[model samples]
Target: EEVKEKAQDVKKEAEVKAEEVKEEVKEKAQAVKEEVKEEVKEEKAEIENKIASTGNYPDLITSLKNNPWTSGDLNTRVKFEDIRRQVTLHEEEITDLPLDKIKTSLSPESLVDFLNMTSAKPTILNRKEDTSYEFTTRDPKEIDLIKKRYGLLDREIDKITSVLIFDKEGQKLKEVKDVLAEGKNRIYMETKF
Candidate 1:
């Protein structure tokens, strides 16, 4: 009977020890879970900044204003909608150049083509803050970029005649030319900074 009693005592102690170990394991798991939640909370804001917002001029305004990527003299990544425009940045030199009022020396080969263009009064869709933009015309030759009211950066569009799409390795992907189409005609081009 004494031997049986000792065995029962040992069994009771073993069960208590097992319960204590189980509770310790649960506590450690809860601590790890809390640590993980804290890490995600810390990274949430930074991750939100990297997420890109894509839309037309109005939709992009908020993104540009809040962009964390744009610091002093840092190049910002931008893209225009299909056929409307797209801005893929290359070359790392950052310059905020100021231009004096002067006629551009660089002439486009399509200048002769532009002479035949009908007179147009287009409502400009681009803002001065935009890194790149496109001008789409509803009617034939109805878009004119030469405006006295445009800011210095906006006037840079006058210098660009065509867009040459290139891959990362400098291989030419596509070249946009001055073409008159039946539907919306776009002058998709890139102005070099």
Candidate 2:
């Protein structure tokens, strides 16, 4: 009777241990599933941020192509409008510069003063209707500075334009991908039991 009780106790202990192990495994599996879900969510968020930053205009373009409509063509129209606005603003800013005031501020001995006093500024000298005067400075350092500034501005404009283009392209690609995915699903459904 003592041996039988000892065996029963051992069986009960083994069963309890098994239950504990099963519970631990379940908890671990749940933890792993949650971790995977969080990682997937983070990855998706990152991609969304990238797409948003680039303007995702391509999607609009793609939608337009897939289903053409006069009013629904937002991508091209918006791009054109943005370019026009930027050009206009640039022109206005350039015109607002006080060129005459700047020239008067310089001493008569300075090269700019000499040019101003003599009206040697190419734009002032070459007043031809068809020909436009291009400013060319002999000082390499000054020229380099000017070139750098010009390049910087050019790069900024290019960056903006690129983002717009990227958006349009991305949108189109997404639409195409969706269509392909649908077709693949249809094919899979037709083939599978």
Candidate 3:
């Protein structure tokens, strides 16, 4: 009995730490998004300057290919003719370079797994009694903070509009830097301990 209780306590603590890491991942993702935006802007400006300096079709084509710039939605390898037609028709936004597709698409919850917060077995979350049916936290400090932030004191629970449960299935790969198309479901757990 004592061993079982200790194991539960450890699992709970690990889960709490995972939640904290998830928040950190969100912050990092936002930062990465900002950095990628700046880099793309710089790359686009440099390419545009080069193209303007060329002042000739042949030189422009060479500059386009050598510079390695791409329209956000276009293929990795684009011809000068295709670029000219696209620009003429205004069908594409060539200046907008989406360099970090993964960072933009990936949810913060999934990023936590990539960060490898710890070798935590999430079986502790399998118990039904451990889940939240509402957006309320059980922690006194967090609850107080939320109440203060939202300016709600002793507010009664209004009827729930909807509860959505998203299920995620994936194997945590080791030493992988590839972008994952999908994301994991975040477990928002609030404990009194």
Highest-lDDT candidate: 1
Task: Report the poorest 10 consecutive residues by lDDT, candidate 3.
Answer: 173-182
**Residue 18 lDDT (model 1):** 99
lDDT of 3 by residue, 22-96 (tens): 999999999999999999888777654444322222332332334342323222211111332332212143322
Model 1 alpha-carbon miss at residue 129, Å: 32
Candidate 1 vs candidate 2, lDDT winner: 1
Candidate 1 vs candidate 3, lDDT winner = 1
- TM-scores for every candidate against the unseen true structure: 0.29, 0.32, 0.28
Query: Residue-wise lDDT of candidate 1 within 87-128, one digit each (tens)?
Result: 322223213222122122112212212322423322333334
Candidate 1 versus truth, CA RMSD in Å, comes to 17.2
TM-score of structure candidate 3: 0.28
Model 3: residues with Cα > 4 Å off, grouped in runs = 53-55, 58-193
Clashing pairs in 3: none
Q: Is candidate 1 or candidate 2 better by TM-score?
A: 2
- The root-mean-square deviation over C-alpha atoms between each candidate and the true structure, in angstroms, is 17.2, 25.1, 30.8
Worst 10 residues of 2 by lDDT: 184-193
